[model samples]
Target: MRPTLFLICPVLLFLGLSYLLPFLGIVQLSFTDPQPGLAQYRHVLSDPLTLAVIWRTLRLCIIVTVVSVGCAYIITLLWVRGTPVIRLLTELCIMIPFWISVLSRAFGWLSLLSNRGLINTWLKDAGLIDASIQMTRNEFAVVVGMAHYLIPFAVFPLATAMRNVDERVLTAADGMGASRLRIFWQIFLPMTGNGIIGATLLVFVFSIGFYVTPALLGGGQSVLLAELIYLWIFQMPQWGMAAALSVVMMIAVGGILVALMRRNAETAK
Candidate 1:
């Protein structure tokens, strides 16, 4: 073989052996465990608890994806439009969150969202509310932490797309008497469609697989599919069930990606 093939061979071999083999094993186990049939998949799909968790997971992922993309778009706009100081500060704010450990970020939010924590205490002392609100161990807290963690993933792709948008086009439109919102709707928004799609997919996929942040924040009442998978594997030692859920997650993610790619391709043509 050639020199490039020789260089790539070890990495390919490692991936096949380490990653592919284990995934194939999981797939096999999902099918063959407890007598060869589709019982595991049927259980996952038909069980009320499993179905509820799936719905909750999808809902949370959708909310996180939308919120993260919206916030990232605004941040990108600010980064692009602001002065040197504003730009520097925005960059720092966006980058700093990614620098911290995600677990630390989750814990930080846990503290801030707790009843006696900063916000509630200040609110009560200020008489903003009659009592301390339920903040931590809830859906609200999960979304907040997940959004914070995923914002950087959303920002980079959006910023890249927004940067490629021609300011000269917007300036020309302004000279022609177009309003800012009109300019964005007619010109900028259409231009950044690909980036927006990419960022949405990235955030959604990451949110679905998320474990620590949601587990810490979502409480017992709001168990996500990831948590359900964890419960099966570690708590109950139901390997077949865990493997089945994993397969479903993989299939869902793969289907989304395939659809996105096909849509992008058709749009390109």
Candidate 2:
């Protein structure tokens, strides 16, 4: 036990320095800036634009999480059902995007969704539409980019959970004449709820902190919390306000994690 604890010490220290230090610094700044009061936080709460940004962030993250999780679930299920070669191909496809830089992916989406993009160009050549349809710089584009980024995150957790489910149980259900839908609904979903929840949280949390995709694809219309935070620091030079908003975002994510943990604990009990 002592050896194990000693071995873990380095990891713990790394986490403290890397994560805890920055978090504490943000907390300190949020309070200390502008003479050490809750004024920054008050401003964050009172400002209508800030509130709208928060709402938009929540809405976008929720949409991204749902779509990513649903798509990942389907992919994972298909992976389970497929032959070894197919599974290997599918996993390769999934992992390939992750190896590529996120900025590259976002830029790729930009090219695809822009008015003079490949799709619009091809459509115009084919005479599908007289005018280029607006695709980029909108909520739809933001969600698509975010969901594409998050789907891999959702896939791994869900696949792990699904893989852990007993093949014998599925066979038994089939032998007992259970329909495919019934088997999935009754056995698979209940057993995999933890994975689904984990994927949801992972995707949602990451989506909330998205900066590049929304900035590039969202334009003026679909501003999110992360863009607002960036604006406060670099553009507006509102350090106090930025720190306060960061604290709020941290608390919101932390609260969600805590709630999920507590619910899981209760369920375990």
Candidate 3:
């Protein structure tokens, strides 16, 4: 084998053994019943609750990706357009968020958004809120937590893409009397938009699979599909049911990922 192919094959083999084999096992389990049939899949698909949970999961994933990418876009722009000191500070802040455990961050958020927590307490003292705002354990809190967790992923792609953009081109457009928004929409955004989409898809995939942030922030009520799957697999040990849900979610993610990759390819040209 060529040296480079030899180097890559072992990594590929490892991934196939670890991720692929487990996934295939899940798929096989999804096809089984208490006696071995497609009952598990039919039951999973026929249920409205499963559909709702799946829809809610997708909705949260989309919202989280949008929020994360929006933040990333602003941060990237500031990093690209601002002073060296400002750029350094923003980059440092983005990295700092990643240094802490996500669970720790989620816990901190609970305090900030809780009624007795900082925001509500401050608001109460100011007479702004009649009661403590209960943001913890709701859909709002889940989206917020997921967005916060995914922000670094979004920023990494957008920042790298933005950095690679030739400023001289934008400067030239500006010199030619293009407006700021036009430069962004027609030039800057479009240029980096592929990377943004890739980041969004990546974040969305991760967010849909997320359990900890949602469990911590969503308070066990607004249970995402990931939580549902986790319950079935680990807590309940209903391997067939869990496998059914996992197969569906993984298929959905795979389709979205294919679309994302194709879009990225077109954007590359």
Collision pairs in model 3:
137-218
How do the residues 39-115 of candidate 3 rate in per-residue lDDT, one tens digit apiece?
88887888898888888888888888889888888887787778999989987878898899988989989988876
Off by over 4 Å in 1: 1-11
**Candidate 2 backbone clash number:** 0
Cα lDDT, model 1, residue 65: 89
Lowest summed lDDT over 10 consecutive residues: which window, candidate 3? 26-35
**How does model 3 score by TM-score?**
0.95
Q: Model 3 segments beyond 4 Å from truth? A: none
Candidate 3: deviation at residue 255, Å? 0.5
Cα lDDT of all candidates, in order? 0.89, 0.90, 0.86
lDDT of 2 by residue, 23-103 (tens): 899999999887689999999999999999998898888889899999999888778778899898888878898898888
| TM-score leader | 2
The Cα RMSD in angstroms, rounded to one decimal, for candidate 2 relative to the true structure is 1.3
Query: Model 1: per-residue lDDT, tens digit, 1-269?
Result: 69999999999999999988999999999988876889999999999989989999999889998999999989987887789999999999998887899899988997898888888988988989988899988899999999999988898888888888888888899999999889989999988888898898899989999999989987776799888989998999888888999999999988988998789778767
